[model samples]
Target: MKNLFHSYFESFKGLRKEIWLLSLITLINRAGTMVIPFLSLYLTKNRGFSLEEVGWILTFFGLGSVTGSWLGGKLTDKIGHYRTMVISLLLSSVFFILLQFPSSFWAICLGIYLVMTVADIFRPAVFVAISAYSKPENRTRSITLIRLAINLGFSAGPAIGGLIIATAGYSGLFWVDGITCFLAGILLLKLLHPKRAKTEMEDTFIQAKSAMSDKPYLLFILAMVLFGFIFIQYFSTMPLYYSEYHKLNEMQIGLLLGLNGLLIFLFEMPLIKFLESRRHTATGYLILGTFLTGISFLAINLSDWAGILVVGMLLVTIGEMIGFPFSNSFALNRSDGKKRGSYMALYSISFSISHIFGHNSGMQLINRFGYEFTWYLMLGFALLACLLLFILKKILLRENV
Candidate 1:
């Protein structure tokens, strides 16, 4: 028992103090991730937008995300990660509050795009910070620790968000989301300050390359974009599935989504630790995890029973647990420490593209065809992603990256 506890503690032992504080900030920021999960439902049910309208709105948000990520990367390189993160957090908070005011469809669409543009600027900055703070050997565990924090916060967000929606409605969700973001900003302001380190300066001088010119990295990004398109449907369409198809309420949808986060929190850390102990390959995990992702969607499309949904959710969560952190670490390993922000930004673009093509096209498919058809599409594409990832892994190994 003592050995087990010791090993668990050791998993978190090597990360820098900044990593710990970043994890805390991540926890606080993600705990209020109420807006996005329920955005589709909010637009449809509250604002009475059509499915296509919601899809377009989400697509616009993705467009902004792409722009923000590119610009944020440059900003992180030119200015610094700390200042970039602080500005993104505070401005995004203001945007979140402003988002609550726009009622018309076009106005709401523009508002959402702006909000996402500002908010997503934080992604690459945070990644750069993680790389800057941790040693190379412990990088994956550091990324996993951040992910663990994110899932822990997600576990609370949906569960509490459900209650807020039930009693206080959509406006309350925005208020709470905005407030928490502001608090996270204030916390960062108090805790983190500017500093110049010799190691960073040396790294900057040693590796001053552009990620855009890296071919292997481009292929890796393509693979993530493909996989992400399929994986992202859980957020974009799954809540509507629970509410409309399975006849679950907002609170029930929240609970079900919360289950995904709770499972990750319980199992991800131990699983990653075990994998690290055994010296598992990132490729092996990525392939298996992607295959499991297909099976997850398959399990549910085959049945509508609530029990089946739980089983599917469990499978998806497990796949996510295995895939995402390793992918982040893989991106980190492939980049120069000096250009970590740029590489991470490029990697983040895959998700932005997924948001655009995934949610927008997904909603269109569901509206035109049916939910089962959409699931079938996701399952088929997930298998394709697995194959692509397998090939990409060989390429990466051959390139010795």
Candidate 2:
């Protein structure tokens, strides 16, 4: 047990201090991720919006995410990652607070759209910052560390958010979320001050290809879109599933959802460290991860017992731990320093596209065909993503040869 614990901590060694600081910033920002997880429920129950209206609002959220990601990339390239990230965090904090005031359908839609647009601008800039901060060999582990922070924050956020909702109402969630964002921004400015942190500059010597023209990378992005589409259903539809089908209350559902992040927080770093030592291709891990994720959906169908929900969540968490870091590394490895912002932006956009379609479609499917059918449909999406990844692996091998 002593040796085992030593090995786990050893995985964290050799990473730069900047990486740790970046992860700390991510943790602080994500720790207050109270609003989004509970957004659908708040819309339906508190605001008295129909499920269809909620779907449209979520779609607008996706649209804003797409816009933010693209803008962040362009801004990172033009102004640098540090400025982009700081600006994104500070501006989004205000928007998050403003989002609480809108009660009408169109007003709510516009509010969510604006808030997400500012909020998601953080994504690509942070990816670029990670690339700048990490060494080539330890980059994957660095990404995992950041993800560990994110999962840790998510682990706490839902449970605390649930308690807040029960006591203070949904409006309390927005204030906390906004405050955390502001705090994270201030911390970043103070700790990773522009003078202290390394700023990434475009390499004048290496000619970088535009991300839009990279066909193989584009195919990989498509697979990610599908993977994200399947995965996001957990956030959007699964909560409703727990409440309506499994007869779980808000607190119970929050704990169950929190279980996913808690599992990831505990296991993902060790798992990624093990995988990093292996000479496996990124696409190989992606294929296996997607298969596991698909199997998780089927796992839910295996038993009607509420215990099965735990089983399904565990499987999906494992798959996420395996897939996400590798995916980020793959995209980062493929890009030159000059165009990394564009590359990561396109990658972020893939998930943003999934957000646009995933929630609304999953809700529609459940309304028409029921939860069982929606799960099966999600399984199919995962299988399709696996297939695309397999093809991408073959193409990469051929190109390398």
Specify the highest-TM-score model's number: 2
lDDT of 2 at 63: 92
lDDT of each: 0.82, 0.87
For model 1, residues 1-401, the per-residue Cα lDDT tens digits are 89877766766776788788889998998897678878889899999999889878987888889988987887777666778888888988888878989999999989988988888888888887787788877788888888888877877787789899999998999989999999999898877655732244345546678688787778778778878988888887888888889998888887787788777766777788778778767877887777888888899988767888888888888888888988888888787654766888998888889878887688789999999988888888878877877887788778776
In candidate 2, how many Å is residue 19 off?
1.0
Candidate 2 per-residue lDDT, tens place, 1-401, comes to 99888887887899999899999999989877678879989999999998778878888888999999999888877777888899998997888888889878899889988888888889998988888888999888999998888877876788889998899888888888989999999988988768432346545124456688899999999999999999998888999998999999999997887788777766788888889889899999999988888899999977889999988888888899898999999998988644777888999999999988887889889999999988998899899999999999999999999
* Per-model RMSD to reference: 3.3, 2.7
TM-score of each prediction:
0.86, 0.90
Looking at model 2, report the run of 10 residues with the lowest lDDT sum: 196-205
Lowest summed-lDDT stretch of 10 residues in model 1?
A: 196-205
Error of 1 at 155 (Å): 3.4
